[model samples]
Target chain A: MDDVLRQGVEIRLTVNGRKHREVVEPRLLLADFLRQRLGLTGTHLGCEQGVCGSCTVVVDGETMRSCLLFAAQMDGSGVETIEGLADDPDRLHPVQQAFWDHHGLQCGFCTPGMVLTAKALLEENPEPSGAEIREALAGNICRCTGYVFIVDSVKAAAETMASNAPRGESP
Target chain B: MKPAAFAYCAPRTLEEAISLLDEHGYDAKLLAGGQSLVPLMNLRLARPTVLVDINRVDGLAFVESGDEVVRIGAMTRHHTVATSSEIRGASPLLSHAAGHIGYRAIRHRGTLGGSLAHADPASELPCVAVTQSATVRVTGSAGERTIRADELFLAEMTTTLAPDEIVTSVAIPRIRPDEGWGFREFVRKVGDFAVVMAAALLRVADGRVASARLGLGGAEGTPRRVTEAEQALVGSVLGAETIEKAARVAAEAVEPTSDIHGSADYRRRLVHAMTRRALQDALGRLEAGHG
Candidate 1:
């Protein structure tokens, strides 16, 4: 057996474009590493189980369920959360801005993950169709707004991002 | 739901993974995406003293398409398989089933090899593997071998995998151009485990069925091939009587066990209705020339 696991292990993860290294238990989930270890609690943990997507984050530009990955699994990996999307104080990621403008959230428990999922989706496809948007965010479950506003927000964001991008570039 | 304390080892090579599994035997468990395993661990339903994390094992994340077989690496993410153009061309049924597993988050992290090895009767991948005639490749210290998909799954949440072995890849053989595929499941939610699921792949040649394969999940302790149904589908045309007979045979072959999601009788009904619908869907695809 590894000695570090018996004691603890040093886990280094790049989150929101920044590098973070810490010692955590083997059972520490990636969600807790962002929330408890790094004080980035914006990423909510609704269902500790994998059903709800509230704990979703982008790992190496791919969306993953943070609750399902152990912190150690992300060693030397790049993690992007909801906080990483907005660099400027006044500006949000197109997906995030679209959510606010379109009233995409009510209780807001599912917003961060929804925005992250949308950002990841639009990053790959700038002009996603309605059905594509539905499929892209199918993992995210929202209680309020009946998911109409959220889907609309992803569509609006996709359009805005599409219009903003240069030709021949991926969304 | 915090899991109990345990040792975790992220072996960097497949050799090390096999060695660790051999050393610990049943005391250790291989941790993949942790989508299914973590839930069990959190509930203390499964508590192992050691966890062999093979996420970093090199060359275990790929989708390989040979001239006739499409081999997916054991650790390949479901998202990768779902979006794989190669898989779309080679075995679209697998790509479709992978997409239908849970949701995006789960798909992004979950693995096909791990899911098939887990052999959960309610999961879609096992049924898909069986329906499509996939071959599961197992690697251990002894040697590498392959198990027919229909023979891979043993029981609920169990498989024929030895404690010392690791599932390395799943090879899905090519589908004839004339074959069509369809899958149907009755789950409470979009991503919930199925109460009853049926998948079909059949080839219509010479105005008659040339080959037929099916996998029924949640209808048996293990996802199994419906030999009785296959016998009926053979040499039949895409007609009402053929479908009815095949559906009845498929339903009768079912050895369903009841649970909270449904009763045995309800599942039996689903077996017939779902089999009929899935067969119709595959037939429609054949007619459209989109196989």
Candidate 2:
């Protein structure tokens, strides 16, 4: 029992292209660790249970609910948060810029997660249909903007990314 | 809401995980995808003093097709099952049911073993396993063993697994070449738990139903294989009359409880309708050359 139990676990992981090492309590969620310990607050926490997708982060290339995962579980995994989306500080990622152009956010609580989800969707599917976009973002809940604008924003982002791709690389 | 403070141990091997479980007994809960268990912990519905994290366990996340079964590792994610070509080719019913689990993020992180071990009556995978007659393999300090799906689930959110046992994998019998399947559920929202769900498989030979399997979820304390309904379809030609009779039998086969989402009577009606629709759907697939 002594070997199996620990007061705190030390985790070493990469977040948004940066390596981090921290010792955290076993119950501290990954969402809180990113916001409090690392001071990356772009990841929002809504409905700390797994219901809301506001705390979604790309862990090992798959979007997962950060609120449900303990910080200790991310020992060696690579995580991507909304803060890492931009290729440059002066420009937003195509997904984020599309949201800005199309008015995809209102109260802004669900924007970061919605943007990251759309980014993953477009990265995998450069030309997603309206229904496909809706299905991809269904886990994320938005109380404002009525979701019509978000769908349009994802569509716009897909178009921008397809056009930006180099000739034969475009899908 | 936050989970209570607890000790966490990430075991890199199955043997080590079993040993940890042996030491902690009921005080520890194995963490798979953490989609279900963490939510319960956050809400304070579950308060284990130790969490044995098995995500790092090697050789526990795979999908393989063998002579008679499609073997899925317990740690296989729902998204992987939903998207796997092998699973779709071997057992289209299981593949289709996996797609109906929670939304994309949940599917990306939730594991089939976690869902089955949780044994939520309203969940899709347990009912699919019961209808498909799958087998779950478990390991404990006493070594490894297998339990049939029918005997695995004992009650609501409870299974026959001992406290020190850990489910290792699930083996689903490959769908026979002559079988057709259908799955249907009535949910208020796309990701909400099913009010009543049905999965039906029919084996046709000589224009008659050679065998049938029917299962209903969210209609009782545990997902049940509706033998009476299945028996009503065997040897029949699957005509409208036979389908209606089986639907009625399915509606009468279980005693459902009323919750805020629905009444027992309403669920019974859903069972009848879903059964009829599922039978029709199965027949359509058979006619469309699912064989």
Candidate 3:
């Protein structure tokens, strides 16, 4: 208790290939940190608890709920949000393109989390079956898509990422 | 909803964490994965004055194999437990129960100790631990001690752990060659808490049940090991009659309370059905010689 500060705490971390060192309130969630302070609003805030996957992001190469994490807890960690998925703004990431082509979203609130989750899945498993794909995204709730097209989108993205992969590399 | 403002400190070592806990006492809360605590804080259910973050504590996240048991660190994430080849081979029932905890995202951040400390009656890990006869290790200002899993849980969202103590790890016995394990839970949604769940560990030798351990969750106010059901299967050959009797005993042992998801009678029925299914599944695995 002696070491605690009731005011803002300074934290340094990497987000979307960029480094940020800022002072934030101890209660600030990583979701709000990204959306409000950094202006990366793609990580949607739904349910505000760990239940909804709308605020999902890649933290140290694993998908996690941003809403459950305090900004200060992410110090020195690498986080990849929805903004970091594609290099070029004109062209979408393969997963996003697959989602678009397959109509995987309707309200689109859960799309960012879904796309990032799919990327994590594909990175771990290059050629996942439909059941595996479904199991991986089971956390991401999509009220609109009914998950049929979301599954199709992830499968399509897997193929696209595999084909676009570097020579002799399976990932 | 937003959490109320609180002071935060990340301890770098277990000693420092324990000292902090001793200093702050009931005013402090440990932030492990934050999967459960942060949500409760957001809902204003638990608003501690200080948060002692244990994420930076070194040497607390590991899984080691001993000669007789598998030792899992407190900070080991659910995904690690679910994907660990060693844990899968030694305690497949624990791994299977970990998969039922939440979805992949939550699993990535949720820790084994956090779930056990939360001690929700409907949670999967506590029931699994009770069925496996695991031992929960804790450290405090007084010293380190181990408590049996069945003795750790007291009531809903409660444990025997003191406010100044932190759970350090859990040790699960390795499945013997003759042991067969099964875990089953029924959930309304993909990631919801189970309505009724059963975990069974059975050892059958020469067509007779050598030993049986049964744990039921979401059926009463506390996650419990059903000794009556275990006694029903211990001396009998796991025949249909024995399984039915154990299921009936399990159902009768629990005092379920009605909730929005199910009525008391409905959950009792589920307890009976799932007890039978879990027993049958374990026996099937035993016959297949799958450990």
Candidate 4:
């Protein structure tokens, strides 16, 4: 606890497969850390209360609300934000591609969280039914698409990922 | 929204975490999955000066079976509890109820211990724990002790746990082969907190209910068992008439508070409907010989 009261605490963690070490205040949320500190604003914060999943990101292979976590808490952990979904901008991740093909976004505010949640779901369940996809994406609310297109996108991504070779990337 | 500034410490062991709690006393709060507490903190509803993060605590996340009970470490995530085959076998009611909690991402980060310690009256885990009569294990600087699920909750979002104590694990009695259980909840949205929830477990012998346990949430300040309803089912044939009688008793027994979600009368009505449906589901499972 004494270390926390200091001006800053040193934290070492990996974001999108890249390692970084920095000194940050214990109260800095992971969402702000990514958006302000690291310049990855894709992780949008809709409701910092965790009701809206717009700030969702993968922490050690599980989806977590970045707004609900302190940057200090993620020390030594691997985090995957929406920015990490695709390697090359031209060629998007399978999930992102499916979202584009299916018109899964109108405002695009929730797309990043939606795509990451769908990616995690597909990794765990290669083939999920429409109901399962809706259930998985229930936390990530998309006010524009009405979730019909989002479900279609996730379904298509599941098929595309299953046909492709097992990627070396962690889900 | 952002939480107020707080000193944070991630202790790597249960003993170390307990000692930190002892030191901080009322000024400290335990950080588990950060699902409930974090949200409350971000909303400025709870402001603890110290956050003792127990996520890094060793040997706290596990689900193991004892001779006649299932021992689940306090830090066991809701995702694991929902999908674990072992837990499903030992306590299908718990597994079923866990699956209904929030959504996939919320479940992944939420923990059993945190849910119990938070003691949200509308939550599924607390209702299930009361129905199953589970025992929570808590540790402090003084020693360790177990509290029954029925006695653990004192009110909404409040538990009987001391400020210096941390819940370690929960032991739930295994549901026997002859016993059947059912859980039902009514929520406004897919992942919203339940408005009214009911769970029932029954053991039948000679076409009559030998033993029964019924619990309801969102109908009162704390999730509670309706012993009058349970008593009504014992030795009964569990027919529609008997089930209706028990449901009426459950509805009458609970004192629900009126809120924006629903009126007190509406909640009582929900309690009746939910109780009847839960009992029917339990009887169906028993008839199918799958309980």
Range of the 10 consecutive residues with the lowest summed lDDT in candidate 4 chain B:
B282-291
Model 1 pairs whose backbones collide: A123-A171
A49-134 per-residue lDDT for model 2 (tens digits): 87778999999998889999999999999999999989787899999999999999999999989998899889889999998998
- Give model 1's TM-score versus the native structure: 0.94
| DockQ for candidate 3, C-alpha atoms | 0.70
Which candidate order results from sorting by DockQ in descending order? Answer: 3, 2, 4, 1
CA lDDT, every model vs. true structure: 0.85, 0.91, 0.91, 0.91
Off by over 4 Å in 2: A1-6, A169-171
* Tens-digit lDDT track of model 2 for B1-291: 899778888899999999999998998899999888999999999988889999989988999999899999999999999999999888899999999998888899899999999999999999999999999999999989999998999999999999888888999999977888999999877777889999999999899999999999998889988999999899999888999999999999879978898999999999999899889899988988844
| Deviation from native of the Cα of residue B96 in model 4, angstroms | 1.0
Pitting candidate 1 against candidate 3, the one with the higher TM-score is 3
For this target, which candidate reaches the highest TM-score against the unseen true structure?
Answer: 2
In angstroms, the error of model 1 at B49 is: 1.6
Best by DockQ: 3
RMSD of 4: 2.9
TM-score of each: 0.94, 0.96, 0.96, 0.96
Stretch of 10 with least lDDT, candidate 3 chain B: B282-291
**Comparing 2 and 4 on TM-score, the stronger one:** 2
DockQ of each: 0.55, 0.65, 0.70, 0.62
Tens digits of per-residue lDDT for model 1, A66-155: 887888778899999888888996998788889999999999999988898888788888888888887777778898888888888898
Where is model 4 more than 4 Å wrong at Cα?
A: A1-6, A165-171
Give candidate 3's error at residue B181 in angstroms.
Answer: 0.7
**Proportion of the native interface contacts kept in model 2:** 0.76
